[model samples]
Target: MNETHSPAFQREQLLAQDAATSNFNYEEFRMQLQNRISHLEKRARQLQKAMWISAGVLILCFPAVLVIEGFRLTEIPWVLPLWSGIGMLSLFLAAVFSGIYSSRYRPLLKRAQYDLQLSMITELQAQVAEINRKLAER
Candidate 1:
């Protein structure tokens, strides 16, 4: 009589396998959430840096045009218009970047944070439940 082939033995093995797989899946999900948060944070930082650089260019363009005009550096009729166009373009880019950062990445980061916290709470609850189960068995 091979006890390993008994129905009870097979049932116990299946239950153990299911528990192991459940734990593995939860860990993988938690790691994926953390990775997403990290990527979003990096993207947000990069977008912020780009926005600041565009804003700096926008701020300098006015003084630059003023100085050029004051010094009478060039008689080209298109020079002033060119500088004004550059300024406007920089302003537009800065505004767009700011909007994207606020409306897109910021919200995603917040949501990811909430998801990570929820996963942590779930993992803790599972641990407590398992401990209680073991204590009851004893």
Candidate 2:
């Protein structure tokens, strides 16, 4: 049980020790995976909030610009429709971009969550194998 033992040796020793216990602490592993999932979920929420906030701010700015150009609207009635059209177009574009951006990252975030779960499962399997090996040794 030297501290400087290689990982394989440590794993072997762990396996040997685990045989005597005949019990695996699965709850700890489950809790760790749950925490990781929670963290990823929070990150997704934050990304969504930021995307919507940015789109809302951009959309709001369009109306402010129209108000600023109100004087020109009176001098040229066509200016009103033109500005309104431009504002609406910009809002539409913002929504499209945000939707695309969110859609893109969402899959990646989900993949990361899936990978984390997979890793935990793999670790559990390794522990189980070690335990079985130790039992066989007896």
Candidate 3:
């Protein structure tokens, strides 16, 4: 006479519990993946912007150097070296940022957005097929 003692009732209870847990886990996992992808995208963008800014600095350096030399501003001992140092530093920063963005963050962001999602979907499909098979067996 007890519903709790019935197989149907027990199966329903287990299924309800599983659905609740799976839904929660899926949402949390999806949010985490989205956050990670967002962070990667932000970093990639920042690196790209920085590389462009450095390029701008390097570009402007030439004219500034020319102006300094034209105006005979290099008469001071430190003036030329200062501009040279700035130019060199900007060039180095641009190269480094470009390399990091192209080689590291950009590739990683692409993988995370596309390849990783595809792999996860494949895995989830396999898990679903297994679950269906088990249910059929039951």
Candidate 1: misplaced stretches above 4 Å? 1-24, 107-138
User: What TM-score number comes out for model 3?
Assistant: 0.59
lDDT of 1 by residue, 11-117 (tens): 88887888666567777799999999898789898998998999999999978977887989658788878888989999999999989988887675456578789
Q: In candidate 2, what are the lDDT values of residues 30-131, reduced to their tens digit?
A: 999899888877776776666676567657766766675765554776765765676676677667656765775567455657778999999999999999
Of the pair 1 and 3, which is ahead by lDDT?
3
lDDT of 3 by residue, 16-126 (tens): 888666567777799999999899888888888999999999999988977997899989999988998989999999999999888887675454578788999999999
Total clashing residue pairs per candidate? 0, 0, 0
**What lDDT score goes with residue 11 in model 3?**
84
How does model 1 score by TM-score?
A: 0.56
TM-score of each: 0.56, 0.39, 0.59
Candidate 1 local distance difference test against the native = 0.87
Instruction: Please list the residue runs of candidate 2 whose C-alpha ends up more than 4 Å from where it truly belongs after superposition.
Output: 1-24, 71-138
lDDT of 3 at 103: 85
Instruction: Report clash pairs, candidate 1.
Output: none
* Distance from true location, Cα of 54 in model 1, Å: 1.2
